[model samples]
Target chain A: MGCDIIVEEKHHVASRTKNKYTKNEYTGLPRKTGLALRFTGLWEGRCLRQFRGRRLAWAGLVAGVLLMAAGMARGEFIAVLYKASRICLECIGVG
Target chain B: MAEVGPGGMGRIRRTVQFAALLITNGYWPGLGRIAIYSGPAKGVCVPFLNCYSCPAALFACPLGSLQSMLAAARTLPLYVSGMMLAAGFAVGRLFCGWLCPYGLLQEALALPRARRVRLPRWIRAPKYVLLALVVLLPVVWVSAGAGVPFFCKFICPAGTLEGGLVLALGRPELRVNIGWLFAWKVAVLTLFLALMPFIYRVFCRTACPLGAFYGLFNQVSLWRIERDRSRCRGCGTCVEVCPVGVPVVEKPNHPECIRCLECVKACPYGALAFTMTEVGKQGSGGTPRISNFKVRNGR
Candidate 1:
């Protein structure tokens, strides 16, 4: 039994050395790759470090869309955008 | 071996070139009014986003005109400045190199052997942040796409002092309604303009949203100035000479880089070179890489 124990320890050491020495092919993707793939336009510098970072940018985008849709669906906001654009053009000398 | 040609010569030539471009854009002949005539026709200005709105403006100033376009846009292109983005992608940030009238201002301010002031990191992000609040925020808010000219309304020392004040001072009606915003603008303008003589284009380096816009072009532009690591000695002279606060050793296409060519002027070796042919010979070949490249950042 003692000899079997010694043999078992030797096998473990051999496997440890083998694991250390082996050079595996780079088949696996790094874990961070998943995170990077998921986020877009959030972390421009990094993966979304900036203020318009994911949360705010998304909220703003949603608000902008809703505001726009509501305005389009309704009346007053429709002409206001058009009118504002015209005024802006004229002011900048393109109107 | 260095980034640009010799300091004094490259600086002078580029300065003269910038002045010529600005004049071509329209600086009232001597003040660079000529810039107005050439920018639209010439198409040589690829780096700096020139204003297309100024009556005297010959070349297109991207930001100034972009704001107007956004304010006016009622449709699908929504939020994106197609032409502007293309131009930026094509040349990256080369406009800071060849064109920018304001970059020339900082270079000129650096003259008469004056001491320069380095801005703190706390302020550097403000320009980009301001870019958001000024450009993106409004576009998102309006949903009509594109941004309101918030810089002009709230911050721009140029518009406030150069155009607004100039127009307001001449017209009484505008003066009549001049409320807190005007005073606020004028006070800021006064401080920045005053600082211009002493602190360099403190506004451009620190606060100019237009500069920030152009800085976005630094990465992909063709004949951009690049640092060849093999040739660079890691000397910090480029930083010392840079008016807009770019760290010389890193890379030229920084968001803050006005493409003034000062670091190109500052380099001791010919490591940095502005090119058009992508991988061709440096300045000695003199192919004039501009003109042909489309302003991809625009429509």
Candidate 2:
């Protein structure tokens, strides 16, 4: 009786997988076309699911902050500072 | 927590914007005379688009600074770009929503109107084109020693409103310099002001290159609005309330999202929220919350 139950469970799992593919094949496309469509759908699903992870976003922020800090340390901001102190002639349309 | 309605949030945002304007342009007194603050703090770049030449302006405009940097050298505008990037990453277009004086003006004008016209999606593309034109065309002219900040001199209504109007009014000597260019700018500013009531943030939606830059970072900014997919009912309230007309349910973190949190306040099920989190982790609800996160809606 236990052996029979295991066979039935395996059959249920296989039928569920078959149903999933059959749902995708409902358009009545050629076999090769259906396979291609299924592959594309799976790829897109994977991409959308993976795209939401926060690690890449945090990495970008950290990199941007480090670059900004480095620029400040190197005195790149000094030019803007000096320029801002004096009146800008061209900006006012007088120069 | 009770949710603040869009109107309440708008008032708070306007108050902050007004405060920012006063702080940045505090030198202006009620008297007819106006004095530009030539302080050390002026060297710092503000994230918004206040005119650098405005007599009362205390900080530099980033777009103007970028143009100047490019006009002076063919190399990349490292300092200005870096500063803007830092701001963009941290808050996205939060500065536009909360700090821009012009944005405040548009929002104020929008308040009195009963009717608003929704712009088509294609109208959003021009700002990117304008950004390219403003940054690139002037570089070539600068290389030939004939370049001006083309956008500022030719197009920016902010410069015309803050600098031109104030200078023409306060400094009689500068009045003689007002000619066709000033006239042209006045016409543009007038048109923009007239359109504000009918169309929300027309300049920001269509032509503000700074908005375009900040919008680029909205997808990855530290502060963001997220929708809990499991809880969302797709009632479409967020779309209706959004000033920029973003389809928030489909893409909550769209680049065009200004991080204004209007959708968060509008969500009936509390499925939407504003949070400080990594880009992919926006829906996790695990990060620190921004102060004033609660929005109380009036019955």
Off by over 4 Å in 2: A1-52, A73-76, A86-95, B1-7, B29-33, B111-116, B143-146, B278-299
The lDDT of each candidate is 0.49, 0.69
- Report the alpha-carbon TM-score of model 1 versus the true structure: 0.57
Report the backbone clash tally of model 1: 69
Q: Pick out the ten consecutive residues of candidate 2 chain B with the lowest summed lDDT.
A: B290-299
Candidate 2 lDDT at B233 equals 50
Q: What lDDT is obtained when candidate 2 is compared to the true structure?
A: 0.69
- Pairs with backbone N, CA or C atoms under 3 Å apart (clashes), candidate 2: A52-B280, B2-B295, B2-B296, B3-B295, B3-B296, B3-B297, B4-B295, B4-B296, B36-B55
B1-299 in candidate 2: lDDT tens per residue?
12234524655666787899998877665223566666677777888898878877878888887887677665566667777887887778889888998887777776433123567889999899989988886678653475567788778888878877777777777778777778888888999988887777788888899999999888777656656554555566677677777778777777666656667666555556565532233443332222222222221
Candidate 1 regions exceeding 4 Å error are: A1-95, B1-6, B9-55, B58-60, B74-80, B109-115, B140-148, B276-299
> DockQ of candidates 1 onward, in order?
0.02, 0.12
Tens digits of per-residue lDDT, candidate 1, B1-299, equal: 11233254444446566675656455464124212233224222223534433334444444554454445553323223444454454454545545565555554555433335667778878888887765554455553354556665666665553455544555455466667777777788778767766665577667877567656756544335666554455546676777556665665666766555656555554445543322212323232222232233231
TM-score for chain A, prediction 2: 0.39
List TM-scores of chain B, every candidate: 0.69, 0.87
